[model samples]
Target: MAGYTVIDFETTGLSPRYGDRIVEIGVVKVSHEGEVYDAWSTLVNPQRDVGASRIHGITAKDVLTAPTFDDVAPALLDAVAGRIVAAHNASFDMRFLAAELERVGYVVGERTPPSVCTMRWSGAFLPGSSRRLRDCCASAGIEIVGEHSALADAFATAQLLASYLDRCGGRPMWGDEISAARAFRWPAPRPAAHTLTYKVRADRQPERADGWLDRIVARMPRSADSRVDSYLAVLEMAMLDGYLSLHEQDQLVEAAQSSVLSRPQVLALHAEYLHAMAAVALEDGILTADERSELDRAAACLGLAQHDVDDALAGAAGDDGADGLVISGISLTVGDRVTFTGEMRMERSVWEARARAVGLQPAGLARSTKLLVAADPDSLSGKASKARSYGVPIVDEAAFAKLMDRLEASAD
Candidate 1:
């Protein structure tokens, strides 16, 4: 893989599945001998909110007039064509790029050039050591500029890859092990069948609607405290779940108009909510005119002296429709069978309640079952293994949390 493309993307949020867009991208081309050839980077107008600006430090102002993803799609496709695309977290980057390319009419499937994930490779080869890009680069003495910037990260990744290759005698493949290595696939082993059972109790209740608000209030610094905490919480949760029906928007706007000191805060929160809702609608590929009108109304409210709200609206409106963030939640109903496997620290009753909230059936991995919740899907003798063997979809705790986050975000 000498002639490879080292690529990185700074995205609006995590996960391409949930509606997060790529705001910036960078690529460095290298030859088989580990010689640098060319480099390219671009700021993309993702057309959506930057979300956690503190994390990435990218704002709408940074990409106000930048080229849209469509503008750079062709050149990007050309740069990586017929070359192995490599990155630290290759799957995350590849999935977002592939989805974006697909939106622009590019075909990407099994025949596409093979891409390698340094993160995965490092885990396999350098187990028990820090495998993060920054840590690895520091160990290899690779110079990195502009850490969060796409181009800089790509350059750093290229250097790391080169260092690894040099240590291996400048060969992409291991000597005699090449043949066996060719068949290697990470995330190895299919799932197997297993049984799991948990019981539901009446004490279990769905989380209160104000749970998020309470957390935000508890975490907020004193200086940032706003007496409108309760209102803000509901609005934020509503936005996250895409729960702002057209009628709801009108009612919210009317309520804001009726309020005195609370009007600005309420309108601003509502504006942010609508911006998120519009993004979800766009991702679902089905925003009706009425929904668009509601979004417009929310945007108009933001123009009423809320600069932050306006910034968020601008970001949402410019999104490229390839954001990867996913928000999910659990909604359990009767007769939904689910299986729990492996050792869990929590009480069996607690686990059963969680399954019920998500409408899962608490049972073993039978053909009649719906889903399986495993403590360690990779465990050799756990239910995860059995579920895999039987081709059942097994979700780990973290994966399930992420799913819920995506579900919640989309619901907004």
Candidate 2:
């Protein structure tokens, strides 16, 4: 075997075609003469949010300043260039690898060095045992220190590849699988494939969205102005990393029902939510990979039948500013879900009491929440960050108190 590169990817989900992406990658290269080169591994800024943080232990803070895929692609190309590519599940890694590479204007072919999965080959030599990475590693007595960490998994996989080489010798047993793997290449991009959206088949138009359940949901505590806030909170988190799990989808549907929105209203809210998230993603000018992932997740969850998430992305990529949510220009009212953040002229308790005295109904930090009263509009508190993410504007406490006084006078 010529010098080879063993790779591993920690991703947001299972499929790149469906918007799942690599948040991190590790590549270890071994020379043709069995000498290992320096290992290459790094956290990537997915630009939206990291997915499955528990499994990978990568947080938004961890990748906040990490290099983007385009920034590191040249170095990655050097690692994989002219080397046999190996992975525990080579297809998974290659799928992400190929997708990431193509997105940055480099289309890779399989013939140059070829790709192979150790899991496929392991079944031939080690029967009766499962082919999971750790299982195969365990069969070979190869301990995986950090099972899902891109670097550790890549290292462990490197050892497993060496073991497979020893057991199978020069004439490996799995010829057909190996050959198929060697020939696999991502298909060339279709004309304007990147721009064309495979529009999601809008669901069967429901006969009636305003049923008894709708009434009950509508009767639920939505803002006096609109129920949009309730949905956006759930939607923003759902698409933060570009892919929504089935569990999240169910939760969103249930939450939508509780909001008393009919099926049509639910769909309409989904569109608005998509635009808001898009605006957030585009706040940084160039939409980062994580942001793209989120747009894809939103499109999928919102029942958009677009094949190309880039379309959703394109719609949101305008100069929307990075000031968080921008509800400043819209008409808002007193009972339309309001809350307070930051230190204010009066104590929070006092402010709340006074506001309530004037018949101003207060709500929590929710999506449909109309206004936020802050001591400092520029406070970087967690609550402020959330308000920005949900596109709610922050009006300082002094402003709020003045408004409350005006309301009291008007009432009298």
Candidate 3:
């Protein structure tokens, strides 16, 4: 038996062949006896937009001030050097690992280092179990508190490797691979200038980092004209999934700068937008859990506090009524063309039929497509990527339902 370094990487996308980069890396060292030794993880600044954030929960903002891959490469190499490297799906992790290492000028001799793929070996150990990390962990009764974060997944993989070792009964299932790893020599690591700006995912942090909204506000002048509809329209589209992506933030900032909207004007518009969402959430004389969640997301993106939602709900109840079901920028109408991507909770045919019921054309994704309703709004599928490139608004299933509700309400 040999010690192992279990690794996991959260990348910008699936393949490095498509120009995707790594945004985070986690490593866990375990002793030959399958005892946990050390665990480490860091958010890497990919220096590009974080792709498929919905899948990994890593946002561009999360890595904005973090160390770049080059900055962390030496530390990462030190962790895996002279150890039997392992991962759940070792091939996928190795692909990105090799790419990143090569980019940073670290070579592992003439061949890729031997790796133990827990997923590939799952059938041998946990027979009849699925290969997904979460699924396999569940089968082994190993709890993975964080599914997508790099460190959490790496630690889980380490435990999974330990389970496989326990099943080996003093023998090594991957003895040949371990022997090969012992002979594998890693390139000398280049020293990196240490940076003090590491960041955990927002949910784990006590305070949310000042994000896109704050940056845009800081750039705004004091007393410009209140031509806010243009900016507000862009804001509506940006927050369709209740997540203001980096690309969408760029769009909003451009709109604000172009229209010369002042700091006070933009702040006022955000307040109004929050109030409008609160009003709609209260339209039925009750705030459902879903509506409350939607309002919270809107407030967070708009840089408003939760108390703002409470205040807005109070003010809305005092008013005669809400004008209509307002969900910021969503306003689907008759003859509007909408499309969908990824798997929806409802059947594709069913959602298309519902779209057609409200006089919307359930069409294929194209530049002319008015909206793209995705199961995961940050979907990395071809259609979703194309829609983002084409500047099409992408919303999740719930937001699509809200759009349908608004359309049906208008008809009524």
- After superposition on all CA atoms, what RMSD does each candidate show versus the true structure? 19.5, 23.5, 15.2
Worst 10 residues of 2 by lDDT: 197-206
Off by more than 4 A, model 2: 31-37, 109-114, 172-244, 247-412
Q: Which of 1 and 3 is ahead in lDDT?
A: 3
Task: Give the higher-TM-score candidate: 2 or 3.
Answer: 3
Maximum-TM-score candidate: 3
lDDT of 3 by residue, 28-113 (tens): 99877788768878889998899767657787788988888888888888888878899876756776788788887777554656
Looking at model 3, residue 260 earns an lDDT score of: 62
Score residue 331 of candidate 2 by CA lDDT: 34
**What tens digits encode model 2's per-residue C-alpha lDDT throughout 218-240?**
21211111234444434543554
Whole-model lDDT for model 1 versus the true structure?
0.53
In order, candidate lDDTs are 0.53, 0.59, 0.70
Best by lDDT: 3
Q: Could you tell me every candidate's TM-score relative to the true structure?
A: 0.43, 0.43, 0.49
